[model samples]
Target: MKAPPFEYHRPSSLDEALGLLAELDEAKILAGGQSLLPLMSLRLGRPEHVVDIGDLGILDSLVVEPDGSVRVGALVTHRQVETSAEVAAHAPLLHAAAPMIGHRPIRTRGTVCGSIAHADPAAEMPAVALACNAAITAVSSRAAREIAAADFFEGYLQTVIEPDEIVTRVQFGPWPRHRRGAVVEQSRRSGDYAIIGLACWLDIEDNTITDAALSFFGVSDTPIRVAEAEDVLRGQAPTQSTFSAAGRTAAGVLRPTSDIHASANYRRHLAAVLTERGLAKATAESGETR
Candidate 1:
């Protein structure tokens, strides 16, 4: 398949990109083009123009903040996140999920912002963002603003991005010291989209769970933060029984749809199993259990 004919613009700066986007209502920003190109090639997305941001220097580097948070540029590839020592030390959960995103070749070309912008319910980064409480920065010709991860994703393949806005950077807060985190997903085959996936972060203090965040994908219209499950784990002593209860609670909130890849019931089951496994691994990593 071939993409529909479209005008192409490679902007050298963020302002220029914003200008192009503002001027062309039907234009699409091209990051790594890993997702957009595929959709375009399939004729699923037919934009009047393609604005390439590859030449923007400011959107291509990872910066570690003095406050311990990490700012990932929009153009930063998944492979960079996977290998970044700064990301590994400060945001291990992101590092943990990076390798699971896709194969090495896909990761090499998939940009973090592109994945977030695509807002696939089955991708790992959105769940990681939700679990880590990351912030996304978006820019336009007029101004720039930050959006919380919880509010960034609106629905399936949908986001809060305005037509002319471009994601510039994503900032992730530092992972808690001694915190336990885990990511588990079930796909039909390696590198395929997940049928259900779970990412969890747990902080233990004085042998009790002080904080717990659980996020899920592929079981809902959007990446969901499992608040009920997190509530069940917080302030509780990590135990098999508690983890089991949390899993059930998490599974109860899922409203998965039957698709070619998996049935809703099967996805629900996977959600429960992955939630349990994630919770168990996170607890053990936190040293909450002897």
Candidate 2:
């Protein structure tokens, strides 16, 4: 199906885009168009105006900050993050998670900020951002502000960003040398969306787990950090038993809804299995670095 009729505006500058957004009603920002276009074609989205920020030359940068965080601009594609040495060194989790996004063609066009703005519950970048403690920057004609990843997501395909505010950049960072992370997912196929996915991070010191972050996607309306499961891993040895316990704790607390692809109980089982697998991989990576 073709998308419904809508007026389109191609803004050449960020300020112009902001002005267009402020002046237009039911306006949608088009950065990468990986998610929005498809939804529009399916009649799921019916925006009256599409403010194309594609020509906004200012939003295409990927920079590493002085404090060790990687800032991904609104137009920085997943392929850029996948190939960036600065991102790989400073924010390894983002690097590790980049390649897992859909496929090469999708990565070539999909923007990190776009993904975060889209906030699909099954998307990898959102959960990765949550686990990395990333900060999202939102800008409007009136003011600019930063939103924590933990509070940015509200529900399935929902975020706290207002209609007039555009997400400019997302910063992922402060990855200490002692911190190790990994991402694992159980998809229907290689490039399909995950049936269940986990982004695991562990800070290990002297063969003991000092801190842990376990963020899961495809199990709820939003990517959730299971604090109860994380507490189970803290101060414990990075052992199979500990990981299994954490997995069980996460499964117990997760309340996933049934869908055509999977039942709620089946997803709970996947949650348990993937949690163990992801934590084990992260722990092994940490051990190797030590």
Candidate 3:
């Protein structure tokens, strides 16, 4: 299948790209094209104008900002992010979650901001962003704003971003060195979309967990943060029984829908089982599990 014919604009500047997006109707911005191109090839997306921003060098950066956050530009490829030392040290959850997205070739061309903008409910990046409380920068010809990850994703494949706005950058705050991160995804096979995935981290001090994060994907319209489970695990010493109870709490509070890939009840079961295993794996990785 081939993409529908469209007027293509390769803008060399961010301002020019913004102008193209703002002025054109049904104009889609192309970053790495790992997500949009496939849909376009299948005629799932038919943009009248294709604004290619790949040459905008201003948006190709991958850096650790002065505020101790890892900032990824719209053009930074997944492979760059996956192998970044700054990402590994500052945002370990994202570092661990990167490889779970598709395969090496896809990651080599995929952009982080593009995936966030796509807002696939089953995607791992959203789960990592939600768990890390990441910040996203949105820009348009007229305005710019920063949106928190929690407020950015509205539903499955839907976001708060206006059609004219482009996701310019994504920033992830530094995770402490004492914190240990883990992402557990249940897919039928490697590189397949997860049936259910869990991304979590534990902050341990004095052999006791002071903080914990539990975010899930593939079970809802958006990444489900298991706040109830986090609350339960905050003060409790990590034991199999304690983790089990928290998993049950998470399963009870979640509202998952039945889909072709999995049933609601089956997803709920994965949520419970993965929650326990994810927490234990993260806690043990921190070397503070008692």
Clashing pairs in 2: none
Worst 10 residues of 2 by lDDT: 281-290
> RMSD (Cα, Å) of candidate 2?
1.4
TM-score of each: 0.96, 0.97, 0.95
lDDT of 3 by residue, 95-126 (tens): 88999999999999998899999989899998
Cα displacement (Å) at residue 182, model 2: 0.6
Worst 10 residues of 3 by lDDT: 281-290
> CA lDDT of 168 in candidate 3?
94
Tell me how far the alpha carbon of residue 167 in candidate 3 is from the true structure, in angstroms, after superposition: 0.8
Q: Comparing candidate 1 with candidate 2, which one achieves the higher TM-score? A: 2
Residues 1-290 of candidate 1: C-alpha lDDT, one tens digit per residue: 89999999999888889999998979898988889999999999999999999999999989888877889999999999999877777777888888998899999999987898889989988888888879999999988999999999999899999999999989998666758888888988988888889888888778798889889988888899988888999999888888888888877887789999989888877877887898787666633211
Candidate 1, residue 186: how far the Cα is off, in Å? 0.7
Candidate 3 segments exceeding 4 Å error: 286-290
- lDDT to native, each model: 0.87, 0.90, 0.87
What is the lDDT, from 0 to 100, of the residue 187 in candidate 2? Answer: 88
Best by TM-score: 2
Top candidate on lDDT is: 2
